[model samples]
Target: MPGGRLSRPDRQRIAALLADGLGYSEIARELGRPTSTISREVARNGGPGDYQADRAHRATEQRARRTKTSQLPTATTVVEPGYGRNPQAAQDFQEQLAALMVQTGMPRMAARVLSCLFTTDAGSLTSADLVERLRVSPASISNAIGYLEGLELIHREPDPGRRREKYVIYDDVWLRTWQVSARQNAMWADTAELGVEVFGAETPAGVRLEEMRQFIGRLSEDMAGGPTEAAINDALTVTAALIHAGRPRSTAELATALDWPDERVTRALRDADYTPDLIDPIALRRTESGAYAIDVRPERLSDVQRAALRDS
Candidate 1:
């Protein structure tokens, strides 16, 4: 029973336990189910305060019937090649991920759409494909796509020689999302600072606002416009190659050593120079021969230490 679907009686018992002031874990223990299962069930069914056993049971039944009917033998209901995956397991995983996303403040339809795209092998889907696979209205898919695009989590691209556009999740989706978050943080910090000015500096509200501004300002400063993971990795690789060479190397030589193009090597070298903190103590410098070399800066030492080294 713990691994099976919740029955109508189970819903009744859960409602009773909730009315008795029992927590999710307590109800789960009583029902021999996982706490997450109990929590998710209650959350989706009008929560504990308004949960009704009969209504929740009916809703679950309707959803199941709709899903079953939509998945009947039809052209759109055919399963894709699984490449050895169990269809039921994949479906369960997708549902679980969508539930988690919903818990994190995403709308239910939007979360479902995002999860469906993520689970697809090609990482892109047209509106028609989404509608067919999700068994939802085209308008629902359109709204979800707009929401995801606003958050920079997905983007639209024109389908090759087709009237329909596809929603694509690129490899750098999270990077763009992080940048959007950083911009939002900066805006919050600015607004908080303005609030501090609106209220008197010595007032209680001003103190709170000032503190918020300082905290978010520091976060924005750290997050805004930072080097991407790809750039950082390239810089480190180039630095290691130069260090191992034990001498200044031309861009062409470095490119050949790393099996990269000369332009790519140049870009890596430039990023290393700009973000020296990624490779502290060791610095990149250009020699008179127009080659790059690793140089250790002695400026990190105290004046007395530098004088002592010079005397030695």
Candidate 2:
């Protein structure tokens, strides 16, 4: 019965997911069917672009009726509901969430996984649970989990009692996405600024590039935690101390280096939302040697370290 004819809701989900930019393979995985099933259905229903849920369902009913004379009865099985979500409503919501995630640049499988976790009451799922619920392969679940983790949408929590780990979405997950998006904006701004110099700032191409640089730089500043003039001025005394320290320092380091109370230095970065210790827009970078450096080139950092600077 698992691979039996798809229901009307299933067709609706397929149509929705197609609109969300999911490929056939991803749809099949989500619906617990073979890839060819979706491929054939889509092709027969006017291809991906024109496929409509209501039309597809009507076509399927017509086809079944046409073959009714030759049909034979098949055995059936009874199963109880595993969750409270109404089948049709749940599938519809999943499709919509998947579409939104796709628009935000998440791959279909990863979107499916994150949406599943987000909707659950616990906001968590083990890899095995994902494979079973999505009716996908273990490898597919693994890959999707990894991708979501990379996006900071989910994290792995060790469950020693069950001897399995669960992937979880935190309350601040949306904020983390903003952090990653801001860093990406910064990267683009840097490239656009470089383009302005290459094409001459007065040239048409350079002018366009300059506009891009300016817009993105402003976005990056907001992402980097913009503080008011009054806020910056208030923290100026402590912030100035870090500048002439002659070396890179974290909160603890700065406190020790300047013989100031640890909490005072810690509070400056938190309250002022300024650089050198936190979101260094134009100041320091972590070097290959694992030290925060003002002059040294940036190193390819781990996801954890990159998150500290702003998400990767």
Best by TM-score: 1
User: Candidate 2: TM-score?
Assistant: 0.51
Clashing pairs in 1: none
**TM-score of predicted structure 1:** 0.57
The deviation in Å at residue 52 for candidate 1 is 8.9
The lDDT per prediction is 0.80, 0.69
Q: Candidate 1 regions off by >4 Å?
A: 1-4, 12-24, 36-84, 225-312
lDDT (Cα, tens digit) per residue for candidate 2, span 1-312: 167888999999999999999999999999989998888777555467667999889967865773563344663332214334354345446555665676668776787788778777788888888886666799888888888777777888996689889888888887988888888987897788678767877789988987787678667768967655654653554456556776666667767766768776644443333233233333443333323334322344565786787743
lDDT, model 1, position 234: 96
User: Lowest lDDT 10-mer window, candidate 1?
Assistant: 75-84
Question: Which predicted model would earn the best lDDT?
Answer: 1
Can you give the lDDT of residue 98 in candidate 2? 64
Q: Report clashes for each candidate as comma-separated counts.
A: 0, 0
| Model 2 lDDT at residue 27 | 96
